[model samples]
Every structure is written in structure tokens, then in C-alpha cells.
Target: MPILKFPPIESADEQGIVAIGGDLHVESLKLAYKKGIFPWPISEDYPLAWFSPNPRAVFDLNNIHIPKKLKKFINNCSYKITYNTAFERVIRKARDIHQNSIHGTWITEEVIAAYIQLFREGHAYSVEVWEDKELIGGLYGVCFGKFINGESMFHIKDNASKIALLSILSNIKRADIKYFDTQMITNVTGSLGAIEIERPDFLDYVANTTAEKEINFQNFSLHLDFDL
Candidate 1:
């Protein structure tokens, strides 16, 4: 399929639900994200529809709230947090968890392959949790400039994913990331301090920040100091 270009995204929403049919090619994925587009079709077999939603759910890394209990767990837990050490494993766990949920999963095989490619190219990253060398939970996302678009997260044990999130927030705090995009709103995200910004406000922020700075995830390592 031909790669879709930017500009069709409506001003009211800044969301261009562009090109409902295409493959998840590496070039296509990179181009899409570079222009603020992301794939979120309903299923693997459905046509690929890229979106830049209005009122995007975003968490200012500085604003993430680590609850007292979670903070305690992080402060004393023996589990270690690592970055990009097991991207595929994290993706598979997310898919498995989503499939078990009532909402089902959209992380198709095509999506998996596409993200793995993104990881290889240094645009995608994962935060992993290990206990006794066993992978328990993690989260993954695409990073562009000062923004990290959180895609999905899963946990095998209680608060495992929460630990991953706390770890991510800590890393972002240490790295000075300005925005953590959640794409959409949900209770899970809401609990983590994500908030909705009006479309215009979001677009303005994106425009002002995306090109002004660069973010390199390799400069930092995960720290499990949250009092989980």
C-alpha cells in the first residue's frame, strides 16, 4: 500500500483517520509517527486506520502519582526493572492480557511485527519487570521528541504493571520528558494522573514541543525506588 501523508487531519480534532487500508510496513510506521499518526484499527484483519485523536490523553511525567502502597512496594521490592531488554516478551504479554479482557485485543500479529521493527530501529521501547529472572510484566511505547506514546501494559502479578509504570515515570522524571501521551482516556490511565486536554491545546503543545528537542532513551536506566 502507498504510504499516507499528513495534513488531512481535521483542525477541530487534529485527528486524521487516514487510509483505512494498508500494511504495517516499517517505513510506513516510521513516517506515520513522525507526523503524529498511529494505527489503531479494531482488529488485525481490518483495514489499517491511522489516528491522531483530539483531546489526547496525556500524562505529564512530573505529575504521575505514586500511591503510598505502590511507593512502598517499589522502595523494598527485589524485582528489577529493565528497558528494551525483552520487547517481544512484553508485547506478547500485553496481547495475552488484552485477549483475556472483555474488550479483547487489537495487538495483532501484524502489529507485533511492526512494533518489533520499530524497536529495532530505536523508535519503540519496553520496560520490563523481573523476579528471580522470570518476566512478570512490562509496558511498551513509541518515543518521539519529548513525548512518549504509551501503547499498552500488562502484569502477571498484583501491581506488576503498576511497578512498570512507576518505573517509567521515574525514568521520564530523571530524563525530563515533558509529555507522556496515552492516546485515549480510561480508568486505568486516569488513576495514573493522565488528563484530557482540549484538541487545540494538545495540538499547540505538540507543535511547540515535537521539533524543539530530542529524547534519547538510552541515556537512562530503570530504577525501582518507588515505595511499592
Candidate 2:
């Protein structure tokens, strides 16, 4: 059976490895996210690892910064953005993109299978950008209670993922969820307003945040506004 609990968040090393050697079963994943942790497979040496990083990277919904040029492009773009659609396709594309990149990839077949199960269980979702009815760019993540932890994103065209991110942020803000966890900062996310907060503050936020009913991303549609 998958372990239902993990080590105390404070026990994590400077690298933020709270625990190692747990299966990515839905029950375990759900518990990990509740305590502000998530899985990261480091290498073949470690089957699976759980992490809760200090100075957690996150986006403040009220302060998301979109470049002016990107905003203009977003306003004029013909792409269609949809939520909870083509999730498998999105993650697979993200995997392929990573696998071919210089950085390699962490989304192994095992990881994909596990997250696909999570998606089926309604704890994960994808936001896709379609152009000419062809999938071009997208992102995926796990959502529990009011917390959304972005996993990865891919784009076949310029600024496509940015559009999807802005759309999700707008909708999430409207739903009253004020933060989006990015785990670690990347150039893409950092340029888009992801900031770091102390681990304890992040845990406290997660502890106080909960939703009796899940936000239905399926009913969500794209908003054309670029003022976000």
C-alpha cells in the first residue's frame, strides 16, 4: 500500500528532500500536496522522492506581470484556450519536449502513468492552447483544495504557454485562489511574476486553505482580455 504520511516538513534537508522511496499512488500524492510537498524523481538511483522546498516559489495572483508585448500578442492572437481538455496529449508533449532538450526530462513513463491516474481522479488538470484546431501549447498541474502546483508546460509556437498561464491565473483569481505554486523558479515563470516565500509561510497558507467543493475547470472558457 502507498504510504499515507510523510516526514515532517521541517526535517527536509537543504535540498528539500523530505522523504524518498514512496510510490506515486493517488492517496500518497493527495497527502503530500496537503502538507505542501510533491514528488520529484531525481534519477535512476532514487525511485521516487518527495520535496517541500524552503523559499517556495509561487505567483501572487494579484500581481502577475505580463510583458506589454506579450499582452498585445495575446489580444490579437487567434489561439483557443481550453481547460481540462487533451490532458494526456499535453503531458506527453511536455514529456517529449523535455526529453529532447539539453536538460533531459523527469516525466518518465511511470510518472506519466501515475499522473494520468490522478487526472482521471480529478486532482490534476491541463490547460491547452489550440490553433487551427491543432494543439500548439499547454500546461498541466495537480490541484488539491485551493492549491494548484504547476508541473510542466510546453509550446510549439511563441508565447503560447504564456497565454495559457495568463488565462488560468485570471480564472483562478476569479475563483478566489490567490496563489499558484511553481515549486522552483525558472526563467519563464520568473519573468511572469513567480516569487519566493519562506517554507513555513507557504505551509501555513496551505494549512489554512481548503475548499469543500472543487473548482470545475471544465466549465471554464478563454477570456480575451489582455489587461490581466
Candidate 3:
């Protein structure tokens, strides 16, 4: 285990990057989450950079809005969704597809290994969207009590990522999740009903919920989550 420490998020300069170059041990990742900070490597060759952005983006579970067209698409699609199934594949694919669409991927082999450890520890999970036995799209993230903080997602076809998102949101209610932290706001997430709040507000939100009080949820209501 590495002896890692972070400056208060308030100490972040305009860029929101708080620290760099800590091993991604499970404890360090957990501590980062607890502090509302996350790792996003600027480039594959760059050292790890931790960020806790201001104007933090999050989804209000009570107000997660699925566009009517996406709702119709999900209702009409032949996708089979499952939880904690193919966790590695989901993360791998998310890394692949996301890297293609954007520059600088943080999902290095080391990141995969660390998150796999977290998954084995039951602190991280994934949502897979399968079509006819083919895994098309999915997303992965860490979950704390009342919150499932999404990390990355990818899609092979149109609306596949949306399907994965809707699936997780629909089912998380079973785990009693009230928030979905997007980490940052983008046009893609903004379209899916993610709204930004202050960073301090987000810190306060997670402070009230911890692993001691929340358990990994199972058996979700798929139909209900898509409706939200």
C-alpha cells in the first residue's frame, strides 16, 4: 500500500488536478472517491492525475431523464442487460471505444488491474449491454452508498451507450441509489439528464453515505429505471 495524501479540493488550481503519481492501490482509489476526487490521465504516457472539478456534474436519481426517443429505442431493442457480469470486458471495451472517440485514455493496463481488484473486493461493478450474444456497449464505475459514480462507457453502434446508461439507472434503485456521479459534465452526459452542482455540495452528499451504511444492491427493476 502506498502512503498517498491529497490536498483539499479547494487547493486545486483552475485545472482541478490536485495531485499526481500515486500507485492505484485499492485503498488509494477508495480514498480518492471518498474525497470526491478521481483519476484521469492526460495521456497514455503521462503519470496519473487526480481531479475534483468544480461545477461537479451528477444525475439526480429523482430526475434522471431518458429522452423519449431513447426510451422508445430501449423498449424496442433486443438487448439483454446484466450486472456484475463480464466486468473486465465492459471496462476493456469502454477503454477501447472511448479512446477512439476522444484523446488521452486513462484506462491503461494498470488501471484495469486496479479496478479489477476493486471489483473482486465488491466495491466496483459494471453494466453490460448485449445484443444476440454480442457485447455491444457498456459502462463501469465505483459505487458508494446511495451513489454509483460512472467511470467510462463505449458503444459499437448508435445508442448503445445510452442503453447501458439507462439499464444501470433503471436497476440501481434496487440498490437504493439516489445519485449518479458523472465526474464531469459533457454534451453527451448533459443530453442524458446529468446536471452540474457545486463540488462542495457533492462532497457533502457523499459524506453522509459510506460503505458502512450501504451495500452492493442486487435485483433491479429494469422497466422502472428506463421510465425515469
TM-scores, one per candidate: 0.88, 0.96, 0.92
- Model 2 scores a C-alpha lDDT of 0.86
Looking at model 3, the pairs that clash are 170-225
When 2 and 3 are scored with lDDT, the better candidate is: 2
lDDT of 2 by residue, 3-63 (tens): 8778889999999999989787778888888899989987656679899999999999989
Q: Compare candidates 1 and 2 on lDDT and give the better one.
A: 2
Which pairs of residues have clashing backbones in candidate 2?
none
Q: Which of candidates 1 and 3 reaches a greater lDDT?
A: 3
Candidate 3 Cα outliers beyond 4 Å, as residue runs: 102-104, 222-225
Deviating ranges (above 4 Å) for candidate 2: none
Tell me the lDDT of candidate 3.
Answer: 0.79
User: For each predicted model, how many residue pairs clash, with residues at least 3 apart or on different chains?
Assistant: 12, 0, 1
Model 2, C-alpha of 216: deviation from truth (Å):
1.8
Tens-place lDDT digits, model 1, residues 94-147: 999999999999999888998998888877899998888899889999876665
Predicted candidate 3 versus true structure: per-residue lDDT over 1-228, tens digit per residue: 753688878998688888887878889988898888888867767788899888788887788777778777766778777778899999998787767764646788889999999999878988888888999888899876655688998888778877878777767644567778898877778898899898888888878765445555465543424646
Worst 10 residues of 1 by lDDT: 11-20
